[model samples]
Target: MTAAAAATADGAAAAARARTAGGGAGPAGAAAAAAASADDDPFLAVAVPPLPRQLSAKVQHAIISADSQLSERLSEQLGLPRPLILELMRFGAVHYCPVMPKAGPNTPMTPEQLAAASAARAGAMARWGPAPKLQVPRRAMEDAPATAGGYARVHLQPKRFPAAHTTDWRRRVLHQGPDCVVVDKPPGVQVSPTVDNVLESVPACTAAALGLPLDSLAGLHRLDAGTSGVVVLGRGGLAFARWWCGLLEARSGGGGSGGGGSSKSGGKSGGGSESGGGSESGGGSESGGRSGGRGPKAGNEAATARAAEAARAVEAAAEAAAATGGAPLRKVYRAATLSPPPLGRMVHHALVGTRRPGEPAHTLMLAVPVEGSAYCELEVVQVKPIALTGAAAEEFGPSAFESDIRLVTGRTHQIRAQLAASGCIVIGDLLYEAVSARAAHEAAAGERAAHEAAASGRGGGGGGADAAASSAAAGDGGGGTAGGEAGAAAAAAASAEAATAAAEAKCGFAVGSAATAWSRAAQADPLRAIGLQAHRLAVYDPERRLGDGAPAAADLGPGWVEFEAGVPWWRA
Candidate 1:
């Protein structure tokens, strides 16, 4: 045995003897048992206790006092020493909310409205909607500090991430082609590097396992840290990677000939760009802050613009599908939910999420689902789903049903949000399921606050109402969390609660109580695994027709490649 393992064994044995002398095997005895098992396993490393957190997990909030160098203002504004703040910043624990420039009008404003806004000193807007709080890295502010009176939302917190140490990353590789490597991503480990540490991510670890340079593999698409599924990584040099990214760019609205304005970009990153992103808006302010990129230098701006246009198109498709009850689905998903819609029914609902700067404003979408909608939408078509009874249902405890989702529009959290909107919350979806339920309560609180503020004459217009709605101002998804922005909260109208709830009975499993639910959902840890999985993935020729968008296509890809992951953790 290794010296460290031997020492641990000896200590554990000594503890066991002491416990035996006192009474029976107790806590020490449990430790001893674990140690003994570790020794027996050939692969087991020396048991080490979890390290205690050195910094507070509670997120610190602040605003730039004035126009100053961002690094210089950190100590005074956030109340931390300059050196310590610098250390945390280097470790990727510091972030600032990006000031999303208001989108210019999509259509001409009414003259009456313009005159009223001019007279009242209120800025004219397409819609007074959810201003998603997007957090990008400190470098953005360091490079360009805000001007005086600009909303500078600064966030400081310690990033504590669990190490994803696997000796056999090669086993996780699903397809290793000449140009790309597809892998079945595990939950908890990030697809990209977190802000604080880069070595613990899937791409880095996988490259290390394959005896390749750390920068050799770059993710083409990223799954959430909590989500387990298919992840495609670009392999080899810059030329092939560029070609692959360029090829994927042709994909849009499910077709091959590539009509004008139908091309979509995957927002491919190169040159190891350390632009931290996470959360719903997918920017620098990740739930677990992250950054870094791979491959040769290439401008991400064009790709980003294409992605924005694609997002707008998806929003349109989703809204139209919801209104028409169905559309030609492109992605198929099978997930376990608390309540499943009727079998063979083209169950449809619009999914919404706010946008940040550089992102296509939710306001740009031509068709909107909910009233004053300031976000995206998605579609789900006919499905053959069944009850997850027997062991699967038992795993769910109270009740669980299986649903087949064929999405005409695929966006982040599309399935989860649509399911929740249909009153079928996905099992263990930490964010949307609970957030929707909690919205009911938050909107109620905001409405009461607005009434009280208006009655008491504490403020004029939406002054008191906006402040009271700080809680609901929280945008959707992990990245669009409630924290970060102080006094920058957008007023989440009461209608959001109704729209999200769809008047379905609240699932006690998600938010039985508001306080407990807040801790679990709104502030959910990024490392916690959810009950969702990309169980199967099949990409077909853009022109192929399928019955109800089933992904068991005869053509998986250009070469007809297909992939299926292992059983879901919950099912297993």
Candidate 2:
């Protein structure tokens, strides 16, 4: 049977078991039973479906009956591309439990035991020592003569996240300058690559679509994965890129926007956006998020000072920049708020360090989560009504008004967290609202729905979230991680919970955790396009000085340019 078919069969069996356990109750009872079963048997959640075009790839898992060449086995059995499989392994997507998961009429775990087991699993995973390479050799328990990390029936799961994939991201290109590629990014797509799936991101796809090398494009500013709008990417090999970077960094030094920074070169930041928790997803981690870069510690004067100093160090280079061709950039975003925002510039400082005793008079501070830091606060510069139409009109619901927000800095989950904290959550952002980054198993519900319809000849249906994953239109996921030894030996012997070590916890966790079911689901979810869009990027010539009043960008004089990626998800 096709992987999809196998998943269907497995789901049927689970649903049937659920019905039996519930004494043949109603559909709701069956559903609850199925969920209970899923906790015991993860396979009920692993459904292989047809890959959608411009959508993300599905999450997958496999059971290892024996041990052989790891990558070869996955590539051959799952029908996934070998190179892609290799990439998954490198990013820690491919995971394994030496022993089989416990399945078949097991006692249901209580919430306490479940929580404890969950913690244990996470701990084991953390110290879970790096996984083996593609060509590593191994033996099952029966084949081992003791004293080895012996395994008979092992459990394995290799997941690929969902990423918005389009061969023509080039067509979406808003502007292609000498050293910058600005594009109207689509919703549900990451601005740049995340730790798990690098190939499906905005920069990577944009580079592929533009016939440029992968590393050629880099982000100067970021948009949330769910937000759709204008993104400025620096073509690092060119002079313009360096100058722009310097300009951005200098602005960071001089306290965000007050005109523009001199165009120069050399600004440090990138590889990925900042990572951390917020009012959205609180975490159980030491750092609160998966960010590898340093962020200001909320209101920590020393940390924020350190951040400012670093930017100042880059200022000299930027100060030397010609104020003309390399000018400062102005950003504007359009969002549908839960309620009308007070009109005017709203200045938010670091949650603690907005102003310090004996601090300089002209000093400016930012909100927590600086550099995606959970500690700092975000500065939402301006919020005003939009000339509404379409989705924006419908989303406003005759109460709240959608607004155009001018930003001082763009960071991950910044808009959602800030807006939600300000008393208006984005229409669909589960991360900051009741749904915490959204549950990973929610996809399992969708999978079960699809399976039922398919079994009943309804052919499959749609309407659900997907992840950020897969380069190919048709990614292979055939015989499962393929059963190596005898089928009976691998028959749900391992605890299904073993397969789920951790979730890419939406509880404020930024792209870091993988191998867990929720991570795949969260990343794959296109529904995550949380009602925010980067509306415009205005590039002003530093040479054109702004007088007492900051005039309209068009009035900023010659050489100044602005790009607007019509927000299709909201108002135009």
- Candidate 2 minimal-lDDT segment of 10 residues: 279-288
Q: What ranges in model 1 sit over 4 Å off?
A: 1-163, 166-168, 243-249, 253-331, 342-395, 442-520, 540-558
lDDT of 1 by residue, 88-124 (tens): 3333445654332332466244777444433322221
Model 2, position 406, has a per-residue lDDT of 62
lDDT tens digits by residue: candidate 2, 1-572: 34643454345445434434444445664455445543353332221210221222234544442345555555556765444444343333354454323323463766775455444434433543335431132321111111112122122222222344432486788777665677888776655444334445677678878888655676654555566777667665423444454455554343332111111223222233222111111111011111112678897997676556545534643654346434356566666765766665544432321223422111122443355222223344455555556655665553345666665543334455456555566765654542223222333334344333322331132212221011011132222121221121222122212222122232334322233322333333433556676676676544322112322457555545677876456555
lDDT (0 to 1) per candidate: 0.43, 0.43
Residue runs of model 2 more than 4 Å from their true location after superposition: 1-163, 166-168, 238-241, 254-327, 350-400, 409-414, 434-527, 541-553
